[model samples]
Target: MARCFSKLTQTSVRIEVGGGRSFDCPMLPVSAIDEFDGIREMLGSVDKPETLREVFRRLREMAARVLPEEYAPGLARFTLDKLIELVAYLIYGDDDDQPAGGQAPADAEDDLYEAKKK
Candidate 1:
Protein backbone atom coordinates (compact mmCIF):
# COMPACT_ATOMS: atom_id res chain seq x y z
CA MET A 1 0.00 0.00 0.00
CA ALA A 2 2.18 2.82 -1.27
CA ARG A 3 1.21 6.15 -2.76
CA CYS A 4 3.41 7.65 -5.45
CA PHE A 5 4.83 11.14 -5.20
CA SER A 6 5.90 13.45 -8.00
CA LYS A 7 9.03 14.56 -6.24
CA LEU A 8 10.53 11.10 -6.14
CA THR A 9 12.15 9.48 -9.12
CA GLN A 10 10.46 6.22 -8.20
CA THR A 11 9.83 3.99 -5.25
CA SER A 12 13.60 3.84 -4.86
CA VAL A 13 16.68 4.90 -6.76
CA ARG A 14 19.50 2.51 -7.56
CA ILE A 15 22.95 4.01 -6.98
CA GLU A 16 25.67 2.09 -8.80
CA VAL A 17 29.30 3.00 -8.38
CA GLY A 18 30.68 0.00 -10.27
CA GLY A 19 33.18 -2.58 -8.98
CA GLY A 20 30.31 -4.77 -7.81
CA ARG A 21 29.08 -1.94 -5.59
CA SER A 22 25.54 -0.64 -5.48
CA PHE A 23 23.18 1.05 -3.09
CA ASP A 24 19.43 1.23 -3.23
CA CYS A 25 18.26 4.61 -2.06
CA PRO A 26 14.70 4.70 -0.80
CA MET A 27 12.55 7.76 -1.07
CA LEU A 28 12.21 9.67 2.13
CA PRO A 29 8.86 9.90 3.84
CA VAL A 30 6.80 13.05 3.56
CA SER A 31 8.00 13.92 7.03
CA ALA A 32 11.45 14.26 5.49
CA ILE A 33 10.37 17.25 3.40
CA ASP A 34 12.04 19.51 5.92
CA GLU A 35 15.25 17.57 5.47
CA PHE A 36 15.06 18.16 1.73
CA ASP A 37 14.56 21.85 2.36
CA GLY A 38 17.55 21.89 4.66
CA ILE A 39 19.67 20.25 2.00
CA ARG A 40 18.57 22.83 -0.60
CA GLU A 41 19.31 25.71 1.76
CA MET A 42 22.75 24.31 2.47
CA LEU A 43 23.41 24.05 -1.23
CA GLY A 44 23.00 27.45 -2.85
CA SER A 45 22.76 27.87 -6.62
CA VAL A 46 22.26 24.33 -7.96
CA ASP A 47 24.24 25.13 -11.11
CA LYS A 48 26.64 22.42 -9.94
CA PRO A 49 27.70 20.52 -6.88
CA GLU A 50 30.89 22.25 -5.79
CA THR A 51 30.39 20.60 -2.43
CA LEU A 52 29.31 17.33 -3.96
CA ARG A 53 30.89 15.16 -1.33
CA GLU A 54 29.32 17.20 1.42
CA VAL A 55 25.94 16.80 -0.21
CA PHE A 56 26.43 13.06 -0.47
CA ARG A 57 27.47 12.87 3.15
CA ARG A 58 24.33 14.72 4.21
CA LEU A 59 22.13 12.51 2.07
CA ARG A 60 23.63 9.40 3.60
CA GLU A 61 23.11 10.91 7.01
CA MET A 62 19.51 11.73 6.20
CA ALA A 63 18.83 8.19 5.04
CA ALA A 64 20.28 6.82 8.21
CA ARG A 65 18.32 9.20 10.38
CA VAL A 66 15.02 8.31 8.77
CA LEU A 67 15.60 4.59 8.70
CA PRO A 68 17.83 4.08 11.68
CA GLU A 69 16.55 0.60 12.21
CA GLU A 70 17.82 -0.50 8.82
CA TYR A 71 20.86 1.72 8.57
CA ALA A 72 23.99 -0.10 7.54
CA PRO A 73 27.07 2.06 7.96
CA GLY A 74 29.20 -0.20 5.78
CA LEU A 75 26.91 0.27 2.78
CA ALA A 76 27.02 4.05 2.99
CA ARG A 77 30.04 4.58 0.78
CA PHE A 78 29.47 6.44 -2.53
CA THR A 79 31.59 7.82 -5.37
CA LEU A 80 31.55 11.43 -6.59
CA ASP A 81 29.85 10.88 -9.93
CA LYS A 82 27.27 8.50 -8.51
CA LEU A 83 26.62 10.90 -5.69
CA ILE A 84 26.06 13.74 -8.15
CA GLU A 85 23.52 11.68 -10.04
CA LEU A 86 21.83 10.67 -6.83
CA VAL A 87 21.57 14.26 -5.71
CA ALA A 88 20.01 15.25 -9.00
CA TYR A 89 17.48 12.45 -8.87
CA LEU A 90 16.53 13.17 -5.28
CA ILE A 91 16.19 16.91 -5.81
CA TYR A 92 14.74 17.07 -9.27
CA GLY A 93 13.06 13.64 -9.60
CA ASP A 94 15.11 12.94 -12.72
CA ASP A 95 18.86 12.62 -13.17
CA ASP A 96 18.94 14.57 -16.41
CA ASP A 97 21.75 17.05 -15.93
CA GLN A 98 22.11 17.87 -19.57
CA PRO A 99 20.70 21.11 -20.92
CA ALA A 100 17.41 20.88 -22.80
CA GLY A 101 19.22 21.43 -26.07
CA GLY A 102 21.66 18.67 -25.06
CA GLN A 103 24.44 20.23 -27.06
CA ALA A 104 28.13 20.06 -26.21
CA PRO A 105 30.18 23.15 -25.47
CA ALA A 106 31.15 25.16 -28.52
CA ASP A 107 31.55 28.47 -26.66
CA ALA A 108 30.84 30.22 -23.38
CA GLU A 109 27.14 29.75 -24.01
CA ASP A 110 27.62 26.02 -23.59
CA ASP A 111 29.20 26.42 -20.17
CA LEU A 112 26.11 25.36 -18.34
CA TYR A 113 27.67 24.97 -14.91
CA GLU A 114 30.74 27.09 -15.36
CA ALA A 115 30.94 30.09 -13.06
CA LYS A 116 33.45 32.89 -13.30
CA LYS A 117 35.17 34.42 -10.32
CA LYS A 118 35.05 38.16 -9.78
Candidate 2:
Protein backbone atom coordinates (compact mmCIF):
# COMPACT_ATOMS: atom_id res chain seq x y z
CA MET A 1 0.00 0.00 0.00
CA ALA A 2 1.02 3.60 -0.52
CA ARG A 3 0.94 4.28 3.19
CA CYS A 4 3.37 1.53 4.02
CA PHE A 5 5.73 2.60 1.29
CA SER A 6 5.56 6.16 2.48
CA LYS A 7 6.55 5.14 5.96
CA LEU A 8 9.39 3.04 4.65
CA THR A 9 10.67 5.97 2.60
CA GLN A 10 10.76 8.29 5.52
CA THR A 11 14.09 8.67 7.28
CA SER A 12 15.38 10.09 10.51
CA VAL A 13 17.73 13.08 10.07
CA ARG A 14 20.47 13.88 12.50
CA ILE A 15 20.96 17.58 13.18
CA GLU A 16 24.27 18.87 14.42
CA VAL A 17 23.85 21.91 16.64
CA GLY A 18 27.56 22.53 16.98
CA GLY A 19 29.78 21.73 19.94
CA GLY A 20 29.59 18.11 18.83
CA ARG A 21 25.94 17.86 19.84
CA SER A 22 23.28 16.39 17.57
CA PHE A 23 19.67 15.24 17.48
CA ASP A 24 17.89 12.66 15.41
CA CYS A 25 14.49 13.63 14.03
CA PRO A 26 12.09 11.35 12.28
CA MET A 27 11.31 12.89 8.92
CA LEU A 28 7.94 14.50 8.41
CA PRO A 29 5.22 12.24 7.14
CA VAL A 30 4.67 12.98 3.46
CA SER A 31 1.08 14.03 4.10
CA ALA A 32 2.19 16.72 6.49
CA ILE A 33 4.71 18.65 4.42
CA ASP A 34 2.55 21.76 4.16
CA GLU A 35 2.12 21.92 7.89
CA PHE A 36 5.82 21.57 8.33
CA ASP A 37 6.43 24.44 5.93
CA GLY A 38 4.03 26.66 7.79
CA ILE A 39 5.85 26.03 11.03
CA ARG A 40 9.20 26.75 9.42
CA GLU A 41 8.03 30.04 8.02
CA MET A 42 6.57 31.05 11.34
CA LEU A 43 9.81 30.39 13.14
CA GLY A 44 11.78 32.55 10.73
CA SER A 45 10.11 35.82 11.65
CA VAL A 46 11.21 36.31 15.21
CA ASP A 47 13.60 39.18 15.86
CA LYS A 48 16.88 38.35 17.54
CA PRO A 49 15.38 34.98 18.30
CA GLU A 50 16.41 33.07 21.35
CA THR A 51 19.89 31.63 21.24
CA LEU A 52 20.39 28.03 20.17
CA ARG A 53 21.74 27.39 23.60
CA GLU A 54 18.39 28.15 25.19
CA VAL A 55 16.41 26.26 22.61
CA PHE A 56 18.64 23.24 22.88
CA ARG A 57 18.49 23.32 26.62
CA ARG A 58 14.73 23.36 26.63
CA LEU A 59 14.48 20.70 23.98
CA ARG A 60 16.88 18.46 25.86
CA GLU A 61 15.00 18.90 29.07
CA MET A 62 11.73 18.20 27.33
CA ALA A 63 13.13 15.12 25.68
CA ALA A 64 14.60 13.83 28.88
CA ARG A 65 11.24 14.06 30.55
CA VAL A 66 9.27 12.67 27.66
CA LEU A 67 11.71 10.27 25.99
CA PRO A 68 14.49 7.99 27.14
CA GLU A 69 17.78 9.56 28.26
CA GLU A 70 19.66 8.21 25.26
CA TYR A 71 17.31 10.01 22.91
CA ALA A 72 17.50 13.31 24.74
CA PRO A 73 20.94 14.34 23.55
CA GLY A 74 20.03 13.90 19.91
CA LEU A 75 16.89 15.94 20.27
CA ALA A 76 18.87 18.70 21.90
CA ARG A 77 21.41 19.03 19.12
CA PHE A 78 18.89 19.55 16.34
CA THR A 79 19.78 22.32 13.90
CA LEU A 80 17.34 25.17 13.40
CA ASP A 81 15.68 23.53 10.43
CA LYS A 82 15.36 20.17 12.16
CA LEU A 83 14.20 21.88 15.29
CA ILE A 84 11.35 23.48 13.38
CA GLU A 85 10.26 20.18 11.94
CA LEU A 86 10.50 18.47 15.29
CA VAL A 87 8.46 21.24 16.86
CA ALA A 88 5.80 20.84 14.21
CA TYR A 89 5.66 17.15 14.99
CA LEU A 90 5.34 17.80 18.66
CA ILE A 91 2.55 20.30 18.23
CA TYR A 92 0.47 18.55 15.60
CA GLY A 93 1.59 14.96 15.51
CA ASP A 94 -0.78 13.59 18.14
CA ASP A 95 -4.40 12.53 18.12
CA ASP A 96 -5.48 15.25 20.46
CA ASP A 97 -4.44 17.87 17.93
CA GLN A 98 -5.75 15.98 14.95
CA PRO A 99 -9.31 16.61 13.88
CA ALA A 100 -11.72 14.09 12.40
CA GLY A 101 -10.13 14.48 8.99
CA GLY A 102 -6.57 14.78 10.28
CA GLN A 103 -6.56 18.51 9.68
CA ALA A 104 -4.34 20.68 11.78
CA PRO A 105 -5.56 23.96 13.24
CA ALA A 106 -6.02 26.66 10.62
CA ASP A 107 -4.49 29.15 12.97
CA ALA A 108 -1.21 27.36 12.57
CA GLU A 109 0.22 30.17 10.50
CA ASP A 110 3.86 30.99 9.97
CA ASP A 111 5.46 34.41 10.37
CA LEU A 112 4.32 35.42 6.94
CA TYR A 113 0.77 34.71 7.97
CA GLU A 114 1.13 37.03 10.92
CA ALA A 115 2.60 39.79 8.81
CA LYS A 116 0.04 39.50 6.04
CA LYS A 117 -2.93 39.30 8.36
CA LYS A 118 -1.85 42.34 10.30
Candidate 3:
Protein backbone atom coordinates (compact mmCIF):
# COMPACT_ATOMS: atom_id res chain seq x y z
CA MET A 1 0.00 0.00 0.00
CA ALA A 2 1.18 3.50 -0.81
CA ARG A 3 1.03 6.11 1.92
CA CYS A 4 0.76 9.87 1.44
CA PHE A 5 3.36 12.12 3.06
CA SER A 6 2.48 15.70 3.80
CA LYS A 7 4.91 18.52 3.31
CA LEU A 8 6.61 19.80 6.45
CA THR A 9 6.06 23.43 7.32
CA GLN A 10 9.16 25.61 7.57
CA THR A 11 9.13 28.67 9.77
CA SER A 12 11.37 31.50 10.86
CA VAL A 13 12.08 31.94 14.55
CA ARG A 14 13.28 34.95 16.47
CA ILE A 15 16.31 34.04 18.60
CA GLU A 16 16.83 36.26 21.61
CA VAL A 17 20.48 36.50 22.48
CA GLY A 18 19.99 38.63 25.62
CA GLY A 19 20.57 42.29 26.55
CA GLY A 20 17.76 43.31 24.19
CA ARG A 21 19.23 41.38 21.29
CA SER A 22 17.35 39.19 18.86
CA PHE A 23 17.60 37.74 15.33
CA ASP A 24 14.83 36.68 12.96
CA CYS A 25 16.16 33.71 11.05
CA PRO A 26 14.55 30.87 9.19
CA MET A 27 15.31 27.20 9.61
CA LEU A 28 18.28 26.11 7.53
CA PRO A 29 16.96 24.14 4.63
CA VAL A 30 18.43 20.68 4.00
CA SER A 31 19.48 21.86 0.56
CA ALA A 32 21.63 24.64 2.02
CA ILE A 33 23.90 22.02 3.62
CA ASP A 34 24.94 20.83 0.20
CA GLU A 35 24.95 24.25 -1.48
CA PHE A 36 27.56 25.83 0.77
CA ASP A 37 31.10 24.47 0.73
CA GLY A 38 31.94 25.91 4.14
CA ILE A 39 28.91 24.28 5.73
CA ARG A 40 29.75 20.97 4.09
CA GLU A 41 33.32 21.17 5.37
CA MET A 42 32.23 22.20 8.84
CA LEU A 43 29.86 19.25 9.17
CA GLY A 44 32.56 16.87 8.01
CA SER A 45 34.99 18.00 10.74
CA VAL A 46 32.70 17.96 13.79
CA ASP A 47 34.92 15.41 15.57
CA LYS A 48 37.95 17.70 15.36
CA PRO A 49 38.10 19.73 18.57
CA GLU A 50 40.89 21.97 17.27
CA THR A 51 38.65 23.39 14.54
CA LEU A 52 35.71 24.26 16.76
CA ARG A 53 36.12 28.03 16.37
CA GLU A 54 36.32 27.78 12.60
CA VAL A 55 33.26 25.56 12.54
CA PHE A 56 31.26 28.03 14.66
CA ARG A 57 32.41 30.94 12.54
CA ARG A 58 31.14 29.15 9.48
CA LEU A 59 27.76 28.59 11.13
CA ARG A 60 27.52 32.26 12.14
CA GLU A 61 28.35 33.33 8.63
CA MET A 62 25.74 31.00 7.21
CA ALA A 63 23.20 32.32 9.71
CA ALA A 64 24.10 35.90 8.85
CA ARG A 65 23.13 35.29 5.26
CA VAL A 66 19.72 34.03 6.32
CA LEU A 67 19.08 36.76 8.90
CA PRO A 68 17.99 40.32 8.30
CA GLU A 69 20.39 43.24 7.84
CA GLU A 70 19.24 44.92 11.07
CA TYR A 71 20.69 42.03 13.07
CA ALA A 72 24.25 42.41 11.81
CA PRO A 73 25.41 44.28 14.88
CA GLY A 74 23.64 41.92 17.26
CA LEU A 75 25.24 38.96 15.53
CA ALA A 76 28.67 40.54 15.85
CA ARG A 77 28.19 41.13 19.59
CA PHE A 78 27.44 37.45 20.17
CA THR A 79 30.01 35.35 22.01
CA LEU A 80 31.22 31.89 21.02
CA ASP A 81 28.86 30.22 23.50
CA LYS A 82 25.91 32.07 22.01
CA LEU A 83 26.97 31.12 18.52
CA ILE A 84 27.13 27.43 19.48
CA GLU A 85 23.64 27.69 21.00
CA LEU A 86 22.29 29.27 17.82
CA VAL A 87 23.95 26.60 15.69
CA ALA A 88 22.26 23.88 17.74
CA TYR A 89 18.91 25.60 17.23
CA LEU A 90 19.54 25.79 13.51
CA ILE A 91 20.64 22.18 13.20
CA TYR A 92 18.17 20.53 15.58
CA GLY A 93 15.24 22.97 15.27
CA ASP A 94 15.09 22.93 19.08
CA ASP A 95 14.19 26.23 20.67
CA ASP A 96 15.85 27.35 23.92
CA ASP A 97 12.62 27.03 25.92
CA GLN A 98 12.40 23.31 25.21
CA PRO A 99 14.30 20.55 26.99
CA ALA A 100 17.53 19.51 25.33
CA GLY A 101 17.34 16.63 22.79
CA GLY A 102 13.58 17.48 22.55
CA GLN A 103 12.86 14.84 25.18
CA ALA A 104 9.61 15.08 27.15
CA PRO A 105 9.85 15.84 30.88
CA ALA A 106 10.51 12.89 33.21
CA ASP A 107 6.93 12.93 34.63
CA ALA A 108 5.32 13.04 31.17
CA GLU A 109 5.02 9.26 31.03
CA ASP A 110 3.21 9.20 34.38
CA ASP A 111 0.88 11.97 33.19
CA LEU A 112 0.10 9.97 30.04
CA TYR A 113 -0.65 6.86 32.09
CA GLU A 114 -2.95 8.80 34.41
CA ALA A 115 -4.77 10.36 31.47
CA LYS A 116 -5.38 6.92 29.95
CA LYS A 117 -7.10 5.80 33.21
CA LYS A 118 -9.59 8.66 33.08
Candidate 4:
Protein backbone atom coordinates (compact mmCIF):
# COMPACT_ATOMS: atom_id res chain seq x y z
CA MET A 1 0.00 0.00 0.00
CA ALA A 2 1.28 3.42 -0.96
CA ARG A 3 1.27 6.20 1.63
CA CYS A 4 0.90 9.94 1.17
CA PHE A 5 4.15 11.81 1.69
CA SER A 6 2.37 14.85 3.02
CA LYS A 7 1.09 12.89 5.98
CA LEU A 8 4.55 12.37 7.50
CA THR A 9 5.03 13.55 11.06
CA GLN A 10 7.76 15.38 12.98
CA THR A 11 9.58 14.78 16.27
CA SER A 12 10.40 17.27 18.96
CA VAL A 13 14.13 17.60 19.73
CA ARG A 14 15.70 19.11 22.77
CA ILE A 15 19.22 20.51 22.40
CA GLU A 16 20.78 21.07 25.78
CA VAL A 17 24.28 22.44 25.89
CA GLY A 18 26.19 23.36 29.03
CA GLY A 19 25.05 25.99 31.51
CA GLY A 20 21.47 24.76 31.72
CA ARG A 21 20.67 26.21 28.30
CA SER A 22 18.44 24.21 26.06
CA PHE A 23 16.38 24.73 22.92
CA ASP A 24 13.38 22.61 22.07
CA CYS A 25 13.43 21.97 18.35
CA PRO A 26 10.46 20.57 16.51
CA MET A 27 12.02 19.11 13.36
CA LEU A 28 10.46 17.54 10.30
CA PRO A 29 12.39 14.85 8.46
CA VAL A 30 11.30 16.00 5.03
CA SER A 31 12.48 19.53 5.68
CA ALA A 32 15.95 18.49 6.87
CA ILE A 33 17.09 16.92 3.60
CA ASP A 34 18.05 20.17 1.94
CA GLU A 35 19.72 21.53 5.04
CA PHE A 36 21.82 18.42 5.54
CA ASP A 37 22.87 18.27 1.89
CA GLY A 38 23.86 21.91 1.79
CA ILE A 39 26.07 21.63 4.84
CA ARG A 40 27.61 18.38 3.68
CA GLU A 41 28.41 19.84 0.28
CA MET A 42 29.95 22.93 1.81
CA LEU A 43 31.95 20.77 4.21
CA GLY A 44 33.34 18.75 1.32
CA SER A 45 34.29 21.84 -0.68
CA VAL A 46 36.95 23.08 1.69
CA ASP A 47 39.64 24.15 -0.73
CA LYS A 48 39.28 27.89 -0.68
CA PRO A 49 39.62 29.92 2.52
CA GLU A 50 36.26 31.55 1.92
CA THR A 51 34.38 28.24 2.07
CA LEU A 52 34.48 28.20 5.85
CA ARG A 53 33.02 31.68 6.07
CA GLU A 54 30.24 30.86 3.64
CA VAL A 55 29.41 27.68 5.54
CA PHE A 56 29.38 29.47 8.86
CA ARG A 57 26.89 31.94 7.45
CA ARG A 58 24.71 29.15 6.16
CA LEU A 59 24.92 27.26 9.43
CA ARG A 60 23.97 30.33 11.43
CA GLU A 61 20.98 31.03 9.24
CA MET A 62 19.73 27.46 9.51
CA ALA A 63 20.07 27.37 13.28
CA ALA A 64 18.30 30.66 13.61
CA ARG A 65 15.26 29.17 11.95
CA VAL A 66 14.71 26.42 14.56
CA LEU A 67 15.81 28.28 17.64
CA PRO A 68 13.68 30.35 19.94
CA GLU A 69 14.10 34.12 19.67
CA GLU A 70 16.07 34.27 22.90
CA TYR A 71 18.38 31.45 21.87
CA ALA A 72 18.75 32.85 18.37
CA PRO A 73 20.81 35.66 19.76
CA GLY A 74 23.22 33.13 21.29
CA LEU A 75 23.80 31.26 18.06
CA ALA A 76 27.22 32.76 17.70
CA ARG A 77 28.28 31.08 20.93
CA PHE A 78 27.61 27.63 19.46
CA THR A 79 30.53 25.87 17.85
CA LEU A 80 30.31 24.81 14.21
CA ASP A 81 30.45 21.18 15.33
CA LYS A 82 27.38 21.62 17.51
CA LEU A 83 25.50 23.32 14.70
CA ILE A 84 26.35 20.41 12.41
CA GLU A 85 25.13 17.90 15.00
CA LEU A 86 21.87 19.76 15.39
CA VAL A 87 21.29 19.68 11.66
CA ALA A 88 22.31 16.05 11.44
CA TYR A 89 19.90 15.16 14.23
CA LEU A 90 17.17 16.95 12.32
CA ILE A 91 17.92 14.73 9.33
CA TYR A 92 19.02 11.41 10.88
CA GLY A 93 17.62 11.48 14.39
CA ASP A 94 19.65 9.24 16.79
CA ASP A 95 20.71 6.24 14.77
CA ASP A 96 24.04 5.19 16.37
CA ASP A 97 25.89 7.54 14.04
CA GLN A 98 28.07 8.65 16.89
CA PRO A 99 31.76 7.88 16.63
CA ALA A 100 33.25 4.81 18.34
CA GLY A 101 33.91 6.90 21.45
CA GLY A 102 30.13 7.18 22.05
CA GLN A 103 30.17 10.95 22.30
CA ALA A 104 29.92 14.08 20.24
CA PRO A 105 32.66 16.73 20.06
CA ALA A 106 30.94 19.37 22.15
CA ASP A 107 29.56 19.71 25.67
CA ALA A 108 26.12 19.19 24.20
CA GLU A 109 24.06 16.28 25.49
CA ASP A 110 22.36 13.78 23.26
CA ASP A 111 18.63 14.30 22.72
CA LEU A 112 17.25 11.15 21.21
CA TYR A 113 13.91 10.59 19.54
CA GLU A 114 11.59 7.76 20.49
CA ALA A 115 11.47 5.00 17.89
CA LYS A 116 9.01 5.59 15.07
CA LYS A 117 6.21 3.10 14.45
CA LYS A 118 6.79 0.29 12.02
Steric clash pairs (candidate 4): none
lDDT of 1 by residue, 1-118 (tens): 4343333323444444478655555555565667667766666645566675566677766655423354347336666455444544643444322222333222322242245421
Per-prediction RMSD in angstroms? 15.7, 15.8, 9.2, 9.5
Ranked candidates (TM-score, high to low):
4, 3, 1, 2
Measured by lDDT, the strongest candidate is 4
Question: Rank by lDDT, descending?
Answer: 4, 3, 1, 2
lDDT of 4 by residue, 89-116 (tens): 7555553223323354121221222123
- Residue 10 displacement in candidate 1 (angstroms): 2.4
lDDT of 2 by residue, 10-102 (tens): 243443447866554453445455654554455466454564455445444433443445666676467766665555554345322323333
Maximum-TM-score candidate: 4
Question: How high is the CA lDDT of each candidate model?
Answer: 0.49, 0.46, 0.57, 0.60
TM-score, prediction 2: 0.33
Distance from true position, residue 70, model 1, in Å?
Answer: 10
Please list all clashing residue pairs in model 1, or write none if there are none. none
Clashing pairs in 2: 23-74, 42-111
Better of 1 and 3 by lDDT: 3
